[model samples]
Target: MAAVDTTLRRTLIEYGQTTLAVVVLLVGWEVLCNVLSVPKWLLPAPSQIAADTWEIRAVLPMHFGATLAAVVGGFVLAIVTGIPIAVLVVYSPFLRRVIFPFLLTLQSVPKVALAPLLLLWIGYGLHSNMIVAATVAFFPIVINTATGLESVDKELLELTRSLDASTARVFWCVRLPWALPYIFSSLKVAITLAVIGAVVAEFVGSDKGLGYLILTSSGAMKTSVMFGVLLLLSLLGIASFYAVAWAERRLCPWYLPTNTDPPAI
Candidate 1:
């Protein structure tokens, strides 16, 4: 109970600090807009943005749902595809040696540069958007899973080997469990990137989703609506991040107890 209370207090303090910072920033933004006599078309006040969002609440939910579906679909695809590839790479040194450099090269080539080609290949719609999002999100999961698998304690592996554990058994019992934390950490990052990728795809070509709404609102000089879309995007990112974090807490409780108090740094 004492430990739980300590953790709760620390979490509340952090949340309060973040809320204070955001309030300061919003107040400053409003002040600057007023001082410079900035047109609403150029920079809407937070209140205007809020009003715009409230006005479009119904339509906004539909657009938000579309974006969410694409993001979740692509994110799941990346995880499913990446983890298997990671396992194969770990199990086969030959394959890892041959493919690691190519994987790195693929990751380096900007996904935005390939979005047009993807659209050409997949055609416009959810499929193209999902492919782009998955491509952008794949590398992190693969790299993190591979790193986790490779970083297994040598002593632990030797012990299992001495016990004559089969490769499949060793992997299922040891490697996968050990890699959970690293994979979840990567998941937190990948979820945000997934949202970005979905938005980028929509920006490039799409009639639906928040990204398309943003483009439309900007073109019409509906600055408040554009700001509202931006806010929705931010909220999407935050929600996905916390969802992953919550799953991590549920699935990997050992890490929290072992780490004890949060680090000062």
Candidate 2:
């Protein structure tokens, strides 16, 4: 009970600090906008963004839902595809030699540049958005998981081999568990990339989602609406990141965030 109370107090304090910082920033921004007589087209104030948010509340949800769906689909696809392939790269010399160079080449090519190809093949839809988002999030998961799998202590593996442990036992008991931190770290990064990927895909080809709305707002010079969309996008990224982080905590209770409390999740 005492520990719970302490945790509650700390949470309140942290939230208070965050709220204060946001308030100060908004107040300063509102003042600067007025003092400079900033054109609404150039920079809408926080109040203007809030007003725009309220005005578009109905449509915002639909756009937000679409974007969220794409991010989720892409993020899940990356995880399912990436981790197994990474394991293959770690375990198979032949596959490592063949696949790694191709992966690097693919990564080097800009995803936005592939927008036209995606549109040509997938044709401006949710699948295209998922592909784009998956492309953006794929590399980190591969790299991190591969590193973790390869970085297992050599001595430990030798001991397991000496014990005549089965290959699956060695992997489950030693390799995969040890790689959880790396996997989760990549997931956190991947979630953010997924959001960006969805937006980028929407920017070029789609008529729905936050990216499309932001593009539309820009064309109309509705800076306030753009700001609102930006805020919504940022919020989406933050929420997704924390959700991954929460999973990390559950999967890896031994690991703790640097300079912070263990996440409740």
Candidate 3:
């Protein structure tokens, strides 16, 4: 109970600090824009963006839903494929040699450059955007999971072997638990990347989503609405990141890093 209380209190403090910082920044921005009399098209004040966001609320649901769907779909696909690839890479030297180089090369290619190819191959739409997101989000998960699986202390592995534990038992009881933290860490990163990937795909080829809205609004010189779309995209990314973090905490409560743990009282 005491530990739980400490953790909860620490979390509250961190959230409060973040909220205060954001409020201060927004207030400063609003004041600067008002004092300078900046035009809305050049740099929309937060107030103008907020007002425009409200006015566009009617159309927000559809565009937001499209982007959300693409993001989620792509993230899920990355997880589904990435973990298995990591496991294979960890357990099989031949597979690792064959696959890891390919993955590294693929990761180096800019997603924007590949987006057009994906559109051509997959056809433009939700599926293509989801594939783009998956491509962007895949590498971190694979690397992290593989690293975690390989990170078990050598002595611990020897001890497990001496105890005559089956491979499955060693993996289930030792390797998987150790990997959870790394996996979840990658998941948070991948989720944010997924959002960027989806937006990139939309930018390249799609007629829908917040990215499309931003593009169209910019072309129309509706900078306030473009800012509003950007704000919405940021919120979506933040919410997705926290959702992954919440899952991480729930699944691996014992894995807190030293830096993040609350100070001793």
By TM-score, who's the top model here? 2
lDDT of 3 at 255: 88
Ranking according to TM-score, highest score first: 2, 1, 3
Which is better, 1 or 3, measured by lDDT?
3
Q: Give RMSD (Å) of candidate 1 vs. truth.
A: 2.8
Listed in order, each prediction's TM-score against the native is: 0.89, 0.92, 0.88
Note the residue pairs that clash in candidate 3. Answer: none
1-265, model 3: which lDDT tens digit per residue? 9989878988898899999999999999999999999988999899899898899899999999999999999999999999999999999999999998999999999999999999999999999999999999999999999999999989999999999999889989999898999999999999999999999999999989999999999999999999889989999999999999999989998987647745664
Q: Score residue 257 of candidate 2 by CA lDDT.
A: 49
Worst 10 residues of 3 by lDDT: 256-265
**lDDT, residue 74, candidate 2:** 93
Residue 128's lDDT within candidate 2 is 88
Report the error of model 1 at residue 91, Å: 0.7
Candidate 1 or 2, higher lDDT? Answer: 2
lDDT tens digits, residues 1-265, model 1? 9988988888999999999999999999989888888899988888888988789888988899889988998899899989999988988999899989988998999988888888888989987898889989989999999999988999999999999999899898999989999999899889998998899899889989999899999998899999889988999989999999999999989876775557763
